[model samples]
Target: MARNISLNFRVVEGRDLPAKDVSGNSDPYCIVKVDHEVVARTATVWRNLNPFWGEEFTLHLPLDFHHLAFYVLDEDTIGHDDIIGKISLSKETIAAASPRGIDSWLNLSHVDPDEEVQGEIHLDVKLWTEAQGPRLRCHIIEARDLAPRDLSGTSDPFARIFWGSQSLDTVTIKKTRFPHWDEVLELHGEEGPLRVEVWDWDMVGKNDFLGMVEFPPDVLLQCPPSGWFRLLPFASAEEDAGGKLGALRLKVRLAEERILPSVYYQPLIDLLVESVLSPAQDDTVTPLAMLDEVSSGESRQDIATQLVKIFLGRGLAVPLLDYLNLREVSRTNEETKADRSGLAVVGRTHLRQDLDLGVLGYKSSSHVTQGFSKLAWCEQSVGAGPGQVRTSIPVCRICAVERVDENAFQQPHMMQVITKNRDGQLDTMYIQCKNVNELNQWLSAIRKASVCNEGMLPSCHPGAFRGNRWTCCLQQDRTVQGCSRTHSAVTLGDWSDPLDPDTEAQMVYQQLLLGRDKLRKKYIEFSEEKIKLEQEVMKGQSCLEEERSGVPEQERPPTATAAAHLLAVLEDLEQAHKTFEQQEKEQVARGSLHS
Candidate 1:
C-alpha cells in the first residue's frame, strides 16, 4: 500500500539570528526539505537580525519520509553561504499533533555532520547449533543512498560487522553513494548481539561515520531475518541551543491520508459487501465481531475506518453514524448528563459576560472603562482640569482581532481590533495590555462575542498599514487579501470524511494472520466443528462461483450474486498474497548470495 501526507505550513519570521557578515547583521533565508531533498526556499532578507517572510506553502509528501527540516543560512557575496542553524521535525513528532497541528516558535539547533546520516542497508543473518558447537553467519548484501562525505559529493563506503570481541570488514566500494558489496562473514562461539556500522573510507584523516544498525541475539531464533534496515546515527546527547542561535515561528499541519479513486477499491468493496450479506448461523459470531474481539485498540480503529468507508460507498454512512451516536447518547447515565449540563451552563455564562451590559475595567497609562455591549473609553484631560469624554461602539460590530507586531506599533503587548460601523465604514481600535497574557485574553473574548455576527472579516493584517503598504506582506493595496491564514473560521464537514477501506482491511487481515496459531490452539478441542464449518463455507462459495460463471452476465440472478463477487475477490486476494510471498523469498535469496 502507498501512503501520502499533505503538509501545510508558514514561515512567519526569524528572531535573534547571529551576525555572519562584517557589517554586524546576517542576510538570512530558509530552505525547507522533506527527508534530504529540498522542497522550497524563502527569499533572503538583507541586513537584519530579525526578519519576517510571512511565506506559506502546501506540499504533498510521501508518508515514509523521515523528517522535515528547515535550514537557515546567511547569504554572503564573497564566499559560500554560512550555515546558521537548522530545525528538524521528525515524522513521529509531526504525527503526534494530529488534527490540530503545531503552531509555535521552535528553537534551532547546531548541525553535526556525523549525526546527519540517511539510507538503508540489506543484510541476511543465520545462527544454528551444529555437532561441533554454535556458529553464526552474516551476509552483508549492499547499502544505498548513504550520505555524501567527500568534497566531490560521493563516499567510499564499507560495512564493519561485530560479534563480541571479534569483528570483520567488507571490501570498500569507492566513489559511489550506492555500494554493492556482497560478502559473508562467519563467527564461531561468539555470544553477543550483532552490530553493523557503515563508514566512508577516506584515505586522508579518519574515515567518517555514515550510519549503523544492530540486531539482538534473539533475532537468530527465528527464520534468518533478511530485509532492508534503515541506517541510524550513533546515539548522542540531545542537541539544544538555548535560544541563542535563533528561533523560527512556524505553523505546521499534517493531512492524514490521500485516498485513491473508487475504481481501485472495487475488489475490497466487493469483499466488504459479501461479508455484510452472508448469512450467519449465530447472530453474535459474525466475521466483523470476531475480528473486533481479537484486534488491539489501534487495529480496531482501522477496522472501524474500513466499515465506515464500505457504508459510505453504499450511501448509508450518515444514517449509520447517526444510529451509533444515538445509541451512545441513550446509554449515557444521569451523572454524565448532569456533568454535560454544568459545562454547557458555564459556556453560556462565559458568552453572556461578553454580550451583556457588565462594565469591565482595563488599566493602562490612562483610565479605560469598557462595557460588554459597547466599548466605552474615557480619556482624562491633561491641561483642561480632568474633563471626561466617552466614545462607544457596539460589540456586535467587531469583526477581527489580531496581534500587532511590537516593532510596527512601537509598543509591547499591543493588539488591533477592526469593526464595521452602521455607515459601512471601517473602524480600528488599538489596545495596549499590561502584558502578553492580557492581550491574548482580550483578543479571545472579543472574537468569541462577535463570532456569529454577519459579515465577519475573513482575514486581517497582523502588521499595520503604513507608508502606503502592509508591513507583513508588503502589499501596496490596503484592501488586498490577507497574507496569513485565519484561525477563527470553524467547519464541521471534516468529521464526515470517507476513509480508505483497502488499507483498513489489510491491517485487519494482517492482525488475524498473526493470531491464527493462537486461535487454533485455543479451540483445539473444537477441531471437528471448525473443520465442518470451513468445509460448508468453502462448498457454498465454490457453488455460487460456478453457478455465476455458467450464466451470462446480464442474466445472472440478482438475489445471491454477492457470493460470486466474494469468491472472485478472494481469488484476487490470494494471488496478491502469493506474489508478495514470492518477492520476499527472492529478496532473501539475493541477500544471502556471495559476490
Candidate 2:
C-alpha cells in the first residue's frame, strides 16, 4: 500500500544567535533538505542578534524518504557561506509520532562543537484558516549581539521575511555589530502565520542566522503589542539574559474579515471527489494526499471526516470504496495469489466429499419405515445401490433454504429446502449434514438453485410442519390437496438472510447525521452574535446623531471628539456584524446542503 506522507515545515523566527562573523553578527538563513535534496531556503535576516523568519512549506512525499535536515548558515562576502549549525530528523522518528504530524520546539543539533549554534526558532503551525480573510503586518526594528562572520569583526547584515511560499529581503547594512532594519512586511491570505529571519550579509558564501521569529494569526490578532522580546539560543541551551546573546524589538498585528460561509466548502469537496473519480498518476498529487499536506493538528482528521461525508452526500461512497480497495489489492499481489492457491486446494477437497452419498432422507410409516423407505432423496436420483430408491424432487425446483436447529433425538446439523411443483404446490424436505459448516454450504446451494430456476416457493406458516402432515396447508378448503410430508425430526435453528446494500447504506447515513447537530449549534450562535453586533451598530449611530444635534449647545471640540468616538465604535460594530453574517450564511447553506 502506498503510504500517505504529510510533511509541514514552518521556519518561524530565531533568536539569541551566536556571533559567527569576526566583524559582528552572523548573517543567517535556514536551509531545509529532505533526504539529501534541498527543498527550501529562507531569506537572511542580517546584522541582528535576534531575527524573525515566518516562513512555512508543506510537502507531500512518498514513504521512501530517509531524513529531513535543517541547516543554518552565515553569509560572508569573501568566503563560502559557513554552516552555523544543523538539526536532522530520521524517517522512523517522524513516523513514530502522530499521524497528524508533529509540531513542537525541536532543539537544533550541531555537528561540531567548535561552531556554536545557539538560539531557538519559534513556529506556529496548524490546519486550515484561523480567520476568513486576514492581513498580517510585521515590523522589524532592531537586534542586539548578532553573530559576526566577517573577517574585520564588524559584519554586513540584512533581514529576510517569509509567509507561505512568498519571500522578501532587507537591504544590507555594512560593518555594524547592531543593525536596525525598521522594515515592515504586509501580507494577505487565508489566515496563517508569518516567518522572519535575520542573517549577516556575505558577498562570497551564504548569509548565516542572526536570529528568527514567527507570529501566527491568532497570536498577532490577540496580542497586538510592540516590545523587545528576548532572543533565545538557536538550539536548546542554557539561558543568559543581557550577556552575549541579546533580544529583538518589533511589532506584529493581524486584521481579519468575517468568517466565510460553509457553502464554499462544496467546491473544495467537488475537487476532492473529482480526484477520487480520476485518481492522479502520482499518489502525491491526489486530492487526499494534498489534503494530508495542507491540514495539520486536530483539524486534519475533521477535514478528512468531512470529506468522507461529502463523498457520501454525492452518492460516490461505493465508487470511493472500490478505488481504495483497488489500491489495497495492488499492494497485496503475492498474498492474493497465495490465497487463490489455498482456495483451489480447499475447493478440490470439498468437491470429493460432496460426491459421496453418505446420508439420505426418506418417509416412514407410523414414524417407522417398513423394510424399504418411501419418498427417498439421494445424490443419485435413480437407485445408486441395492434397494436404494430414486428421489422424486428435482434440485431445479428448490426455492427457499434454511438451517434448522438440532434437539433431542436429532443430529446437530440439519437443513430444510423448499421446492415448488408444476401446479404451484410446494413441498418442504429436511436433510442432515456432517456439521454446521456443511449445513450452511448446503443451504446456500439450495437457495442459489432456486434463484437460477426463478421458481417461487410457497410460504411456510408457523404450524405448517406439525408431525407428518402440514397442518397449515390442511386448514384450507377440502377441495385443495393438502401437502402430505413428514417434518424433519430435528429442531429448527436460527439464521439471518443475506445483507441488502440499500438497507445498509441507509443505516450508515443515519449514523452520520450526528454532525448536523453540531452545525446547527454553530449556526445559532453565529446568528445571535450577528444580531448583537447589528444592535450595537444601531445604538452607536443613534448616539452619534444625538451628539451632533447637541453640538450647538456644548463645547464644539468635545462634541466633535464624542462624535468621532461613536463613529469608530459603529465602524467596529459593523465589521463584527459583517463577519457574523458571513458565518451564519455559511451555516445555513451547509445545513440545507445535506437536507
Candidate 3:
C-alpha cells in the first residue's frame, strides 16, 4: 500500500480557525514536481512558513522528491502550500510565487483592495531543496514601485525601479536592494516591465554593458547566408566566477520596440492580463555556440544533430533530458488559442528550447523560409475579365484579363487591395468593411498604417496583364511554425513588348541590369573582405586534413569559428551559380523539345 501526506497549519498573525478538520486528510500531497514525477516534498509534516500572516505549517510526504524536479505555478498562483497557490500537485516551477504566507501572496479576489481587511494577499510555495547544478537563475531583481518584493534567491542582481502611472507628470526614481520576492511586485504594466537584471552588476559595470534581451537578429532576409547570423551577449557567467549564480541586471523603459514580436514571425497571441512581459536578462543567454557547420551542402537533419552536439559540448545547452517542463510555443495563435493550455507540436517541443534560430524559420543550416523562390510581376488594368464575365463574380475581375493567378487576393470581396507602381504611379490600397462602424474601428486601431515596399499589383498575362488596373489577394499570416503574422496577395504591372518571346525575362533583365552595377560593387567588397576568412580556413584545413584523413568529416569537422564556416559561405555562392546553370539547361531542353 502507498502512503499519503497531511498538512498541519497554524496562523501566526492571520486568523487560522481550523479551515478544514483534516485530522485524516490522506491525499499523498506533494509540494512541487516536474511533471507526473515529484521532485521535492516533505518526508514528514515539516514545519514551514504559514500561508496566512507568515505563520507556520507542516506538511508530510515521501522524501524521495527532494531533488529530482522543480515546481511551477500559474503566473501569480502557488502550490497547495498556501491558500492561493494551486497546481496539479506535480507541475514544475515555470511560474513561481512570492515567499510563503506573505502579504503579497494574495487571492485574486482581492485584485483591488478596498481597505486593510478587504485588502488582497498573495500565496507562495517553497522547494524543499535546490539542486547543485548550474541553473542560470534569471531573477528579475527589480522593477517599478509596484514591483513585488519577497522574492528570495541565494544569489542576485536584484535591483528595483518604479514607473508611476500616467498623469503623474514627474517620474521619480528609487534604488534599493529588494529584500525579497515577498511582495507582489508587478503592477501598472502599461507603463512597462519594471526593468531588472539577473546578472552581477560588477560585470556589467566592467564591460559597460547596458542591454536589452539579446535576441537573434530581428529582420533577416529570407535565406540569408549563415555567416550573417551571430550571437549578441547581454551578460556572461565568466564575469562572476565566485558566485553560484550570475545576475544579468536588467533595466526597463517604455520603448516602442518592446511591444513588437522579437522577430516579425513570432506574433503576440495575448498577454497574461495584468502581467507585464519583462525582457529576460541572463549571462547564460549569450549563444554558447552557433550550431552552423562549415557546409550548407550537408542535409539539414545531419546539421541539426551535429549542431546539437556542439551546442551541448560548448555549454550553450544542457542535454534535452536535463530540464523538465520543456515547452514549445508556436508561431500561429489560432492553433494555440484553441487549446486550454498551449501545446508544442511537431519537433517544436524539444528539450533544448533556446538554440540556433529554430523558431522563426531561421535554422542555422536550413532554408525552409526560402524554400520557394520570390518573383516580381506587375498589376495591369482592372474590371471584370473573360474569366469572370461568364462565371460567379467571386472570381477576380481584374485578374481574369491581367495576370491574376499570382495575386491570391484577386478574388472578389477582397477585404483589402494594393496596386503597385510601375512607372512611378502613386501606390494605392483599397479596404472594405461590412459597414462604416467596422471601418471606423479598423482605421482607429490600424496598427500597420504605412508602407514602403512599393512592389505591387502585377499579373502574368502573356500580353494583357499590364493593361490598366490590378488586383491583390489575401492570406492569413499564420506561419506554419507557430508564428502570428498575416500574409496578403498583391498584383503589379509594367510595359510589355508584344513582339518579343518573353516579357518577364525582359523586365528582369532590365531591372537586373540597373541594379547590377551596385550589386557587382557590393559583391566585390564582400568577396574582398570574405576571402581572407575563407583563406584562413583553407589554410588550416590544409594542415589538419592531410594529417587526419581516416576520421569521418562529421566527427572531426572543421572548427565552427574557423575553416568550417567558410564551407557554408563558399557553398552559398556556388549555389547561386548552379541555379543559373540549371536555368540554362532547362532553356536548352525546352528548345530541343520544341524542335
TM-score of each: 0.45, 0.25, 0.16
When sorted by TM-score, best at the front, the candidate numbers are: 1, 2, 3
Q: Rate the local accuracy (lDDT) of all candidates.
A: 0.62, 0.46, 0.23
> Positional deviation of 32 in candidate 1, in angstroms?
2.0
Q: What is the lDDT of residue 262 in candidate 3?
A: 21
Residues 337-373 of candidate 1: C-alpha lDDT, one tens digit per residue: 5533221233233323322423234222211112134
Return whichever of 1 and 2 wins on lDDT: 1
Report the number of the highest-lDDT candidate. 1
How many collisions per candidate? 0, 76, 72
* Candidate 3: segments with Cα more than 4 A from true spot: 1-551, 554-595
Report the C-alpha lDDT of model 2 over 1-595, residue by residue, as the tens digit.
Answer: 0122446666776667678888678888777766434456777888865668777654445455566777777777895787665666767766666444555544444544223322222223223333655555666665544445665544576767777776778777775544556677666674556666777777787666566666676666666536654332254543223323322221111111232233433333444566578875644344344333333333433343334334443556455555544444454557544533221233233323322321122332212111112233563111123443345556556655654323211344555666777887777666556544345444443443244356443333322343453332223333343222222211111111111122222222222233333322332232323354346547775433333342343333322332233233334444544666777789899999965
Q: Give one digit per residue, the lDDT tens place, for model 3 in 1-595.
A: 1122222222222111112213422112122222122223322222211221222222222322221121111111233332212222111221121112112111111111111010011122111122542111122322211211112211122323232332111121112111123333333323222222222233223311112222121211122122111112233221212222111111111101111112211111011000112211321111111111111322233223323322232232333222212222222366634531211221123323434323222121222121111111122224433222211111111111211121223332223332333454333233333332233222221211111233323322111112232111011222111111122111111011011112222222222333333332332233323454345546765422322232333543223222222222233333544565677689899999986
Error of 1 at 23 (Å): 2.1
Measured on C-alpha atoms, candidate 2 has an lDDT of 0.46
